[model samples]
Target: MLPPRTYVFFGLNAVRILGIISMLLVFASSIFVLVHDVQAVNRFMAEASESDMQDCDYIPGSTVPNQPAGVFWAVVNRLLIIFQVIILILSEVGWPLAFFDRFFPVLGSAFGLGALGIFQALIGAAILSHHVDDFTLVTAFFLFAIGCLNMLLGLIFREGAKARRSITNWRAQAKSVLPSAEDFRPAFVRPNSSFVPSMFKSGAGEERAEKSGFGFGRQGEKAAGLKGFLISKPLESLPRYAPPPRSEGSRSNSPEPQFKSSKYAI
Candidate 1:
């Protein structure tokens, strides 16, 4: 998870500052290399052999190895600067333009810095391989260092931005899923209508009665007297259980008691 807004603001400002510094470095180095390449090209053209000219008639010949690579990097650096400035400006300005970051983070500082880092590394490697002058050597070293820094910053920024987006998306989803005030309205009330049903009138009267107290007002009196108006009626009683009458055939099936007569028996 990313830190809170207070830290995020500071973090973004720091990233922007670092990005600007990287852009400046790239611009200055690219300009230096480009100027040097141009001068070298002029010198090469001036001292070129007739056979060298014949071999390459379209473009000027250069004795410098990987001369094209220098010019190519110069162009690439210029483009990188342009994009970096745009990303930084858009990020700082906020709101409408900030939407650019929201919609396309790939075009944002994270991706821009990452691309610049990768490009700088490539340029440093090219400089190391092709030419080794004191100025170029120092430039390459700085570029390599700056490139690594940019890459690290890019990664941190990307993860932070991802977390931020996720938080926003979560809040939006939660808001959408939650029940609104309209959802809690009484069942008798229609969603599209302003009219409340008469069923709620009794409830409103009860509320008023409670506020005024039982004997304070006519409404309170009515509320209190409602129970008196409701009379209690006695419930009908259930029948008691009884045995069924015996049939003659059933009586005949039963054995009779035998009586013995004794003298003076009553």
Candidate 2:
């Protein structure tokens, strides 16, 4: 058994499909009127005299004086307009009830196109009554085509809604099946102890030195004064003749022996 929401979705889709079919019907009817009826009307108007052209009513069984074809096309055009209006209303109502998001614009477009179709139909009828031209019929055809496109867009939006719903359902299902971060566990047991000490433990000596106000080298002695900030002479600037310092052990082990020059006797 299907869920209630699924039923609603299917119902909305059915309404949308019906709207598209009606729009196509309107488009085809307009084309028929343009090709068959409009041409026949134009031919009759062209052949008839000025006296015959003045009256809008069609006379039956008379070839030169009547335009029954034009009257029939006008009637069919108006009927199509009525059908388009009903479909537009259904679409506007159905889309809002089905989808809770971002469907108003699509509804508005359909409404606008339906209105344009009616307007064009009326204008075409008026023009056909008096002055029938190629431009009139072409414009009417184009307007009906736009209405069909609006229906096609609505169908596309319906498909998009279905896709969005499917994705949302998939995400919900995945979230239900997958474990959360807190529940995750490693395959192997990890050691709690580390060879390297923590920063907090390492900083203990430095903290004690800071509290005693003595530097790192000697304990019980204060830090160096501002003279420490002065730069010492670089190695290259030191006197070359100066001897290197000797270690305490080496100095203590030295024997008190007199040195003899190379020119003197040993």
Candidate 3:
């Protein structure tokens, strides 16, 4: 895919084209109203001079307030357009000098374009509202539509720019957070035998001593010898006492005495 800057470049040009068209419409509508009003004033003067009724006073401002406002906005719009055009020409021509980085310095920006779009839209709406029944209505309507489209494009570009900036900032933060290969190294932990309980380790040491035919010390050798001696002895060697048998004919009517034996006694 193409880069975002390329898209923005094309989009800005589109806005400029639409803006130029809207400006032309504004000029046409404003000129039509001014010319019509001027003609009306001339007719009224002629009628008045030709012995017309004194009550036939023609007031120019009484027609509609939108005519004057439309003219005012048209003038302002021309100036703004001229300013942007000059900046664009200067930036482009001085590109090799690196004097300016952007094509349309201020109005080329997202917020600036949005503001311009809003201004044009307001002007178009005002003019269209007053010229509803006149031929100028068509031009005013077109101007209004173009202005709204420009506004939408401006807002979309602005959001795109914001997203790009946010992504750039996030990437910068992530890069700062990541550790460098030079500064990062993996460490492996080794278990210390000193921290282990002797009871759990003694069995392994005893087994090793028996296999090697050598003990860890005198205590280990004695423990090994004792364990070997016990394993070699027979179970019959332990003495067990026998209880006397009772006969059914002996009617003593007495309970047998209970005896508790120790663990080793059995």
Residue-wise lDDT of candidate 3 within 46-110, one digit each (tens)?
Answer: 65453343333333332322233544454454455444434433322333323332443334323
Query: What's the lDDT for residue 178 in model 1?
Result: 68
Candidate 1's TM-score: 0.38
Instruction: Give the alpha carbon lDDT tens digit for every residue of 1-266 in model 1.
Output: 65475465556556545545544555565566556656776676678786775566233432144344655554565456445545544443333434656785554423445654565566556556644346656766676676676577667765454334333444664578564444666555666654554433444665755553555567655665775753344685555775666899989999898888989797
Best by lDDT: 1
Which residue runs does candidate 3 get wrong by more than 4 Å? 1-8, 48-110, 132-135, 159-266
lDDT of each: 0.55, 0.48, 0.52
- Considering every candidate listed, which one attains the maximal TM-score? 1
Q: Where does candidate 1 stray beyond 4 Å? A: 1-16, 51-104, 109-129, 132-140, 153-158, 161-266
TM-score of each: 0.38, 0.31, 0.38
What residue pairs are clashing in model 2?
A: none
Counted clashes in each candidate structure: 0, 0, 0
What does the lDDT read for residue 83 in candidate 2?
A: 60
Cα shift from native, residue 174, model 2 (Å): 10
RMSD of each: 14.6, 21.8, 22.0
Give the better candidate number (2 or 3) by lDDT.
3
